[model samples]
Target: MITLQLAWRNLWRHRRRTWLTASAIAFATTLLVFMITLQLGAYDMMIDTSLRVFTGQLQVQRQGYHAKPQMRATVPDAQALAARLRAASGLDGVAARAQGFALASSVSRSYGVPVIGVEPEFEARVSTLPHLIKQGRYLSSDQAQEAVLGAALARNLKLQIGDELTLLGSGKDGSIAATIVPVVGIFESGNPELDRHLVQLPLKTFQEVFTMGDDAHAIVVSGPSHEAIPQTQATVAAQLAPGSGLVVLDWEQLIPGLRQLIQADMVQNWITYIALILIVTLSIMNTFLMSVLERTREFGIMLALGSSPWRIGVIVLLESVYLTLLGLGIGLLLGGGIAVYLHYEGFTFPGMAEIYAQFGLPGVIHPKLSFAGFTLGPAVIFVFTVLAALYPALRIRKLQPVEAIHAV
Candidate 1:
C-alpha cells in the first residue's frame, strides 16, 4: 500500500509526461476498436447479402453437377431430399431449382438468357426473389407458360408484364424448340449477372419444357441461424446421400469471392490492431525511460534512506499499471459508446448506397461487438505497460547511490 501511494505521487510529479503517455494508449485503443468494428460489420453485411440474395445457407446438388451443370446433370430424388431437409431441426426451409440457357425475344430485341425454374411458395421462403419483385406479381403456383423477366432484361427486350415473348432453346433431346411464354412479372435483383440473364418459370413448366422429369439441378436449404449452417448441412447431406458420391455445398463454398473478401477483411483488421498496439507500446516505453532519468536523484535518495532496489522497481511497475488502467477505462467507454451507436443507428455512405443496392447489399452497416474485444483492450494495455517498464526497472537496478544522488 505504501509503495502504491509513492508510485501515484511520483507519476503526478511529472503530470505532462504521464498524461501524454496515457493519451497515446487511449487513442490507439480507440482506433483499434473502431477499425475492427467497421471491418467486422462490412464482412457480416457482405456474407448476409450474398447468402440471402444469391445462395441459401446450403445447397444439395447431383453428384457430378458442380463439375458440369448441364440440363442432364440433376438429382433424381430432389423432392425426397427436400422433404428430409424440411423435417430437419436446424433447417428453416428448402427449395428446388432447375436452370438452363435459352434465347428470349420480343418483337424489338432478342437476347440469350438463363432460365431458372422454381416452386413459387418454397422459393419465396428460401430466397429473396419475392422481395425483389419490382413489378406485377410473383409467379403463381397455378400459372402455366408464364415467365418472370429481370428488369434489365425487360428493358433490353422492351417487355412489360402480360407481353408475349418467344423462347428458343433445345428441349430434352437437344432438338431446337420454340415456345411463347407470357411475361408475368419483372424483377430487379441488384446483381447485373442475375438481372441481365435470369428468367423465372414454374418448376413443372420448366420440367415439361426442358424435358426434366423428377430431377432438379439443385436443392437450396436455409438454416434457422447462420451459425447453424454447417451442422444442418451435415444432417441434410447424410439424409440426401448415404454414400460419399454426392457433394453438399455451403454458401461459403458456392461463393469463393465472398469468402476471400471476408478473409481479407479479417487479416486487415488484425494488421491494423497490431500496428496500433505497437505504437502505444513505443509511446509508453519513451515516457517510462524519461521518467526514470528525471527521477534518478529521487530514487537514489529513497535507496539511501533504506528503500531496496526491489521496492524501487515495484514502484515503477505500479505507476505504469495505474496509468494504463486509467487510460483503458476512458478508452473502453469511448469505444463501447461508439460501437453501440453504430450498431443501432448504423453508418451510411451516401453515394455508395446505389452501388450496394446494385449488388443486393444493405445501405446501412451495423457493427457487432464481442465480449473478448471489449475486455481485451484493458488487458492488452496492462501488458504493454509492464513491458514498457522493463527498461526503466533495469536502469534503476544499476543506479549507484552516490552517482544518482549527484547526477541532477
Candidate 2:
C-alpha cells in the first residue's frame, strides 16, 4: 500500500508529463477502435449485399459448373435436390437457378443478354430480385410466355411492360432454341452489369425454351445468419446422395473476388495499425525515460535508505500501469460512443451510388460494434506501455546511489 501511494505521488509530481503521455495513448486507442469498427461494419454490408444480390451464402452445383458454366453442366433433378436440402437444419432459404446467354430483340433494337430461369416462390425467398422490381409485378409459376427485363436492358431494347421480346440461344444439346415472350416486369439491381444485360423468366418456360428439362446450373442456399453458413454447408455436403456429382461451395469460394477484396483491405488496415502503435510506443518510452532521468536523485535517496533495486523497479511499473488504465478507460468511452452512433445513423458518400454501381456495391455504410474492435486497441496499448516502462526500470536498477545523490 505504501509503495503504491509513493508511486502515485511520484507520478503526480510531473502532472503535465503524465497527462501528455496518457493522452497520446488515449488518442491512438480511440482511433484504432473507430477505424476497426467502421471497417468491419462496411465488410458486413458488402458481404450481405453481394450474397443477396444473386449469389446466396452457399451453393450446390454440378462438378466443374463454377469453372465453366454451360447449359449441359447442370444439376439433374434439381427440384428434388432442393426439396431434400430444404428439410435440413440451419437453412433459411433454398432456390434453383438456370442461366444461359441469348440475344434479345424488340421491334426497334437487339442486344446480347444473360438469361436466368428461376422458381418465383423460392427465388423470392432466397434472393433480392423480388424486392428490386422497379416496375410491374414479379413472375408467377403459372405465368408462361412472360419475362422480366433489367432496367438497362429494357432501356437499350426500347421495350416496356406488355411489349414482346424475341430470344434466340443454343439448348443443352446444341439445338436451336428460340422464343418470343411478353415482358411483364422490369427490375433495377443497382449493379451496372446485371441491370444492363440480365433477364429472368419462369423456370418452366426456361426449361422448355432452352431444352434444359428439370436440370439447373445451381441450387442456392442461405443460412439464418452469416456465422451459421459453415455448419450448414457441412451438414448439407454430408447428406448428399452417394453417387451424386454435386458439390457444395460457400460464398467465399463462389465469389472469390469478394474474399480477395476483404483480405486486401484487412492487410492495409493492419499495416496502418502497426505503424500507429509504433509511434505511440516511442512516445511512451520517451516519457518514461525523461521521468527516470529527472528522478535519479530521489531513487538514489531511497536506495541509500535501504530500498532494494527490485522495489524501485516495481514503482516504475506501477506508474505505467496507472497511466495505461486511465488512458484505456477514457479511450474506450469515446470510441464506443462514436461507434454506437455511427452504427445506427450510418454514413453516405456524395455521388457514391453511381460510383459503387460499377462495382456492385452499396453507397451507404453503417459501422458495427464488436468485442475485438473495442478490446484490441486498448490491449495493445496496455502491453506496449508496460514494455516501454522496462527501460526506465532497468536504468533505475543500474543507478549508483553516491553519484546520483552528489550530481543534480
* TM-score per candidate: 0.81, 0.85
lDDT of 2 at 71: 86
Whole-model lDDT, model 1: 0.79
Local distance difference test, each candidate:
0.79, 0.85
lDDT of 1 by residue, 45-115 (tens): 77777677757877888677766777777877666667777887445579888888889999989999888
Mind giving the per-residue lDDT tens digits that candidate 2 earns over 1-408? 878997788888878988888888888888888888888888988899878888899899888889888789889988778878888754548888899889999999999888999888889778887778889978978337789989999999999999999999998889998999999899888877888998998888898889998888888997557777888888889867877888999998899999899999999998988889889888988888888888888888989999988899999989989988888888888888888888888766789877876455667777778898789878888898899899888888888889877758
